[model samples]
Target: MDIEQIRKRAQEIWEAEGRPEGQHERHWQQAEQELSGGGELPQTSSPAHHSATTIPEGRGKKKSDAVPSLGGEPGGFQPGELASKKK
Candidate 1:
């Protein structure tokens, strides 16, 4: 039901079909299709979703330990709140 599960399942299917290298896009698409019961998964926003860091700014760099700069942003937002709000 999660992205990893979907990805693993997709990889298995892709390999079963014929483990052709460089077909990552096809594997992901097929995986999303199967996971969504033929409906489209929300199109991937970017490669950030699959990378180690959630932020796209630092793709291969180590995350800094410095204090985060919220820059006058409002507080009281809990984890998953923003995503839940969208639903």
Candidate 2:
């Protein structure tokens, strides 16, 4: 998402959460999730993705794990690419 979208979503989250303290980053993260289409449906996969957690039936919304940086990609990376590459 862009700066404007992130800022807008972050503000929305901050306000929704009653404006808690020490959670600016968290709010920003949730904002990205919101503006970046976090709630979009994910396709069911094969056994490899079996272990992946699925959102509950009534709780299909996806939440962001962390806040992206102000600029650039915010350090996006795969968790197990090295191990898989060696195989």
Candidate 3:
């Protein structure tokens, strides 16, 4: 991948998203994805959706819910269990 092309595309993405702060990595990844012909990035309807902390309605889970396991287990393991198992 061309660094210059990626930089230009990232700048375009940054400008298109109103130049929000602290999103350099995301913009760079998106630019790379586009330049590599992976697929077009999904367009957001509003600039507010660009905030990293803004979880969309109906998409977030309650804190009480079990986080799903990567191994396709029924009930997920506790937070520290995965690392313990690895060791």
What tens digits encode model 2's per-residue C-alpha lDDT throughout 1-87? 599889976777666655666777866776777677899432223233344566558673654446433333344445434534534
Candidate 3, 1-87: lDDT as tens digits: 999999998888888877878888888888888899987763432356556668798776665356544445544455557655654
Q: What local lDDT does model 3 show for residue 50?
A: 50
- Per-residue error (Å), model 1, residue 57: 54
TM-score of candidate 2 to 2 decimals: 0.42
Residues 1-87 of candidate 1: C-alpha lDDT, one tens digit per residue: 689988897678666655656767867877778787886554333343346545577554864445444434665334335634544
Each prediction's TM-score versus the true structure: 0.39, 0.42, 0.49
Indicate the worst ten consecutive residues by lDDT in candidate 3.
Answer: 41-50
Model 1 weakest 10-residue run by lDDT: 41-50
Candidate 2 backbone collisions, by pair: none
Q: Which stretches of candidate 1 lie over 4 Å from their true place?
A: 39-87
Worst 10 residues of 2 by lDDT: 40-49
Misplaced by over 4 Å in model 3 are: 42-47, 50-87
